[model samples]
Target: MTLQKVNLQEKFNLFQEQWRPKIVGELNGQHVKLAKLQGPFVWHHHENEDELFLVVKGRLCMELQGQEPIWLEPGEFLVVPRGVEHRPVADEEVHLLLFEPAGTLNTGNVQGERTVENLERI
Candidate 1:
């Protein structure tokens, strides 16, 4: 594969859908994804895979079960461990970069209308 640098803003400009994640890069069984998020997402957890969320713009409120919400801002990131139930909420449009195992489902263990089984590569 040809190696090239990815511009976050340029890649983000290619899509405008919320909750849907687009693949940007990959390495060592992990995928670097970009997504635009607004509103609340389903509460779910990966049975085996861990997830990393990095805010590129706006704010993210990560809600953990039976605990207070953790807020993330631009340039900030949070790692949600495996099997830990969590939900991501955004009051406004938020740009995010996610690092997780390849083929990891956006909806985790929950298979619902919001689940994205086929992720688009941008």
Candidate 2:
């Protein structure tokens, strides 16, 4: 293993696509990912792994089934519990930091257009 700094600004600059998550770091059995999101995402749930989303820039809305959407701004985070159906919607471009198990799929159990089975590290 080697020690190197992971600069968010530099990492974020590596991509421009929306809803695609890029790996930035790994800890324990989890992956620390960065993503740029815009528009609405599919409503799905992780059957086994909990997902964490931290807004880095702009704003995001976490919409859970049967519940009011939770709004998150920069520095705010939300942990979507395993098996809870939810979707993320961003009116504008949003920068986010995501933490989840290494093999956790971006689309959770549902396979759709936004599903990412393999994510590249930046």
Candidate 3:
């Protein structure tokens, strides 16, 4: 098997659309995804999957139900456990790296226009 290093900036430059997650790597039934985020996202929760959000650029405010917002800066990360309703809000364009189980939906329990059923591999 051949192994290659993935460049995060190069992969991020391949897409400009916000809220769309592009797969960059996979391991142990999990996917490493990259996305550009702005504005607020839907409030949702995963039934059985935990999500890890790593801020690559800008800032991210993770809003949990009935809780104070958790701020994440560049090089910081947060893991939202399964069954916890949460939302991500960005005041400006933020580059993010997400680690989640394979086939995990971006919108989780709530599905609507923002749901990305098929993710593109970069």
lDDT of model 1 at position 122: 87
TM-score of model 3 relative to the true fold? 0.99
| Per-residue lDDT of model 2, residues 21-119, tens digit only | 999999899999999999999999999999999999999999999999999999999999999999999999999999999999999889978888889
lDDT of 2 at 75: 96
lDDT of 3 by residue, 17-109 (tens): 999999999999999999999999999999999999999999999999989999999999999999999999999999999999999999999
Which of candidates 1 and 2 reaches a greater lDDT? 1
Cα lDDT of model 3 overall? 0.98
- The local distance difference test score of each candidate is 0.96, 0.95, 0.98
What is the Cα-based lDDT of residue 89 in candidate 2?
Answer: 98
Prediction 1 TM-score vs. true? 0.98
- How displaced is residue 27 in candidate 1, in Å? 0.3
Count of clashing pairs, candidate 3: 0
- Angstrom error of the Cα, residue 35, model 2: value is 0.6
Ten residues in sequence with the least summed lDDT for candidate 1:
1-10
User: How does residue 41 of candidate 3 score in lDDT?
Assistant: 99
lDDT value for model 1:
0.96
| lDDT for position 21 in model 1 | 97
Candidate 3: regions farther than 4 A off: none
Question: Of models 2 and 3, which has the larger TM-score?
Answer: 3
List, residue by residue over 15-113, the lDDT tens digit for candidate 1. Answer: 998999999999999999999999999999999999999999999999999999999999999999999999999999999999999999999999998
TM-scores for every predicted model: 0.98, 0.97, 0.99
